[model samples]
Target: MAFEIVRQECMKNPEGRSRPCNPEEICEVLENNQGSDAIQGISLDLSQVGDLQLSADVFRKMPNLMFLKFYSVGVKRSCSVKLPSGLESFSNSLSHLKILWNGVKNFGNLREINLAESKQLTALPDFSAAQNLKHVDLCGNIKSLKSENQLKSLAKLIVVGCYGLKEFSFSSDKITYLDLRPTSVEILDFSTGCMEKLQYLVLNCSRLKYLPINDICCMRRLQSLVLYDIGGLIDKSKLHSLFDALLSLKVIHLDGAFKLTDLPNNTKHLSRLRCLCVSNCKSLQSLSELPPSIEKLGAYECSSLRTLQLTSHFEPSSLADKKLLGPTLCYSVSYLRNLQRLTLKGCEQLYELPEFMDSLSSLSSLDLSESNVESLPASIKHLSNLKQNFLAGLKKTSFSARIAAIPRNC
Candidate 1:
């Protein structure tokens, strides 16, 4: 009865039979390999009846399998194996189907899939014939697409850290690279039309609010935009024209946007921006209209921003957009001259440390943890390959006099 074997051609079901069998007479008697590390008995029931796990009696005897993979039980399985229904002739009988850790509900000629760490999966089935899927990694599942049309024929989907997803139905514009980072998505509605071939949009720590970006500008070939820890009701002035129609943006990451404050004015049209990261924006104060093809800038702990103006002191008048007062916010470190790596940890009203700092001299690596920094502005020795320097929550008498004048490469 069971005879499906793609690529090696055997398939014969709709009645025209060619049933044959013999995976050692329906698996269960093994020894040749001596129970390869026992995940179960008869060598995993003779590898689910020969050549890698496949149950339901291999559709009566090979129905045209192009490929079928099923490790079906690992992660210390005690019970996880009950997914083998007579797939409606699985897309004309298999092209490639991979089901692991069991629990899966059905099968389709999957294009490519990896249900890694299927922590007792929750939901995922009704796959409309997989429709030539491209790539899918249901990393550590807790499934929640409830059937967004069974993901309309995915292109590339990586649902990393899926904490019981609550929603994601922007349709499916042949997804380009949509990683709902560190998911727990609050409210994301990519304005319909199913994501018009989204380019690269990472919504990290999605606790979003009002993130429509004018419908994500219909993903006009979006380049890269990652927003992290997006806390409540976001409206950072439409985040600079919501990528001003993307025009192939470079890279922009607004980390831990704690109720973001401001950054709009079309952010100088991105102008092929390089990399700009506003970290832990504790109500970020200002950095208005930044756009000089920025080269990596990670504003640490924001702390109500203080100062950092380039392009000739960025004179945008009105008391330099006042409000930014304490917890120091870079009042000018030579305007991050091609900043390499700078993370002023927990800037606690930074205690003066920017005396004409040789324009970061392409600073290498610096993470002044929990600052209250007492001293160390000997121009930081112009960070020549500055190694690892983390002055952990200083105060020990200026932490040994700024850790002895930064020579250990900082």
Candidate 2:
């Protein structure tokens, strides 16, 4: 009766033009009652459904309904569901199922399934028929599986935040992107041959002392790699080797790695690399050089850095040397004709301006705040197109005031 009403209303109103009576007006009482033997191939999950019992007739009526899901609806006690033996009639058709927050047990499936986060539940039935299952998430449960072979059919798996999981086993050929963060996992055995196609890898805050270099080297197509805040990753030998192995890498971000003192040895060889960010490394003293293909360089909050080298791939003669030219360290920064903006904040060692400062024909704005600079370069007066100039909180103000007082075109 319920299915007929639902189907008729759904089909009659092609564009949903008719309105049915509101659910508030409908009755909640279960009309039919039957014994448990009538139910077949039935699966159902419900949460906080207080004092609810499945009469055998209602169970048998849903012989074809194989999948069910239920969550908490404010019930004080768990709902105890009884499985009728009639399920054997439709066992082959009942493949996938889930029972969350419902006291369900002795359920069987032939293919895919999940039973996660039902604290009050215990006991798991053997699922030998579940051969076609590809993904499974059974987190937050303490019940131990009878054997690890149950997971052999799964390809992609998620067991995060599962406290009681001491150990398990499965095939790795079809699985990729396994997340073991914030766990007690000491070592991951990825010697399985299926890791070749893995691309994006993330190991943030894993507390790992080291990683499997061979496994990472096998992923030839790896594009993005992130390894931040790992405790024992002080030496760059392994990291350099890993970087050397990834010939197709495009982006590498390693932030807050306090123990990293030296840069990767062959880092400049990432020929196709575009973006590199190494911020908040307290021990880094200076940058030797960078790849010319790099488009963005984020080296913020790196206190130990003293020298910076900027180069281009066009030609050596095409580059200009502005080192120690004067009290301020400004040089062919204008040659970075492609440079859209420039900032020199807290550059304490700088004292003089580079001769190229006056010829920055492309610079729209300049910032020289919180520096030891005493005066603006006389060449600045020559930049007739100057729009915005930032020289706040300098060591001396008289020099800036005199420059501001000077007449333009002087």
Candidate 3:
């Protein structure tokens, strides 16, 4: 039942092997072989089938099936597709399920469900029978999802684009990752600090003005944090203190924050930090200090930044001007030897490059696209190990000569 016979000779020989078939062929096989206990999983792409007459009875007979997935691009607007029903009673073996851009409305009896970009999916059926369910991702406009007791085991839930979802509740301490990036939830009350186990939280709500800072601090294990494309709802003061509270944090991404002028004061203390991405902040003037352990740094489109400072961990003798050095180094990025990739795209007001731009011997990549820098220092030719240097669409093509002069010696 898993493979379809391609020719008449194949069907004539009962012991012959079969080959993989298209979605239409698989549907025919499912129709003829009603009770297939050996087929543990089935993945179908029904985008080309104009009118599919799929039925639930065909799947109900497969007692041992564990995985089910259906992918359709614009199926609701392009064609008619009938999905299986009574999936809530799917055999206990069912675990993983995914439906992408399809017209499926209800599904159950699975431990995980990843339904993304399906605009026609309005609801998720009851989960009372899906006791094994643990993770669900309905990231696009799901309107009808109800509460149930089976959520106790749920570990990860991402409902980012569900605009009609006002609020949803769960055991705050049990869930680890919760992403409400584009949901219509106006407010979230985390003052009780019940989400101690929460690690990754993404919020981009339009009406959310204040977040539970104390609750976020209570999440001792929280690591990766992303606050994307929201208005100035969160106080920059609270965000500044998060690095001190979340010692396990490694990545921090904040994009399109219109009110943030400065970041956390003690960024160098983040021992395990690896990546820092801050972009699209219209009012962010400059960064006073950066962590010493960072490997990837992106400061794209911060139009107001005029100066950047790196951690003062290098000896003064390594720099050309020892008298100009301050408690924290400014324009001394040459000492950030651990940095492998750096991007400063779209900062339109900057007119000069750092004097020690080429001292970063370990640096492998640099991007300065769409920036207003008027000249590149002659010392940029000192970057011996640089692999990728991007300078697309800059003013006057000043970096062209310095880029062409780099020695080809490996």
Candidate 4:
């Protein structure tokens, strides 16, 4: 009978449109069919409703209810729906919930909850009884979240754009993926025995001045680590410590870190690292020997960079030495054997390429646009796999005809 009432209300609207339900109308339907065992689903659009006050046992009588979604669309004002305190339990069969309420006590069967963009939500309900909960996505002005020793089964968590969030910590050892991008979180506490199974972490907080390096080093299975715009938070020594611990990492992306002057001098320990990208780091001056496992290397708009050492054999003590003519090339040995794509665009101070450029036999695409490179090494003609070469703004170079004459039949 409850489903019949909801169906009749929907039939009054246009084919593909829904009429927003007010507080009184919604209360009437639920009250009239309070004990009905037929209500299995409910989706209400409360865009036109104002402040709604409901009893605590409103959903207690619906034993078979499995899904409940109460959302507002195109409403500019705060959508307030007050659920009374001591709301003991949702339906025992309920599995999915997407609402803006804070009174539910026992979510024994619930699997996922999405409260994204709930601007008025400042606190989370106790989830001690929610043993089956697995995924949670939270966003808005939430200030503090401490999921200590809870959510034993949680596997994924995302908390993006929470500008007012200041403190956060989760002790879910089963979690495999976590993202906290673009937040104002200042205190992130990751104590022992937390996030041990995590495989991916993306942190883009600008105000985060310190990272718990000891706790992060515990994530031995982490594969991808992306740190964006976290200015001056990680110095060279701390980064070196991180590299030593996170040896299983495959991809490392560092961008907009204005205080970084150099990467770790010896990355050969990261044997599995495949891609290394450092861009827009204006203060970075040099790149030392990288792991031979790197397939793609990109350093763009690093305005202060003056040297690139591709192998351990080529070492220069200082950038001021005029004798350091070009990229230190190894004539007898081939390094970076698996390298496929190399981009050094917008590095205006970089003046030369390795004279033994042919050693990079797997090189396919090369971009040196808007740089100060004087000439392309003649050895480049021997690269049989070279396909795309971009030298757009090299006005000071004398290799235009030489570059065009290279064979393209890769």
The model with the greatest TM-score is 4
lDDT, model 2, position 385: 48
The residue-by-residue lDDT of candidate 1 on 38-152, one tens digit each, is 1111113333333433333333233233233334333432423342432222222222233332344444544555544444446665555557566666644454554445456
Model 4, 249-273: lDDT tens digits are 8888888888889987556679899
Considering summed lDDT, which 10 consecutive residues are worst modelled in model 4? 13-22
Relative to the true structure, how large is the alpha-carbon lDDT of every model?
0.56, 0.47, 0.63, 0.70
**In candidate 1, how many clashes are counted?**
20
Consecutive 10-residue window with the lowest summed lDDT within model 3:
12-21
Q: What is the full ranking by lDDT, best candidate first?
A: 4, 3, 1, 2
Off by over 4 Å in 3: 1-109, 121-131, 139-150, 191-193, 311-334, 397-410
RMSD in Å for model 4: 10.8
Q: Estimate each model's TM-score.
A: 0.31, 0.48, 0.66, 0.71
lDDT at residue 256 of model 4 (Cα atoms): 85
Across 1-410, the per-residue lDDT of candidate 2 in tens digits comes to 75455436545432121222222111121113321221222222344343344333332323223334333455667655443421222222222333322342333432333333333223344444445445554544433433334334445554444445433333344454444333434444455344555556655434444567777787777776766555556447776888788977777777667777667757767777666766566666555445545555555555665555443232333234333122133323323332234454554543444544454444444554554556655665655544444544455547655466232544
- Cα lDDT for residue 216, candidate 2: 77
Q: List clashing residue pairs in candidate 4.
A: none
Q: Pick the candidate with the highest lDDT.
A: 4
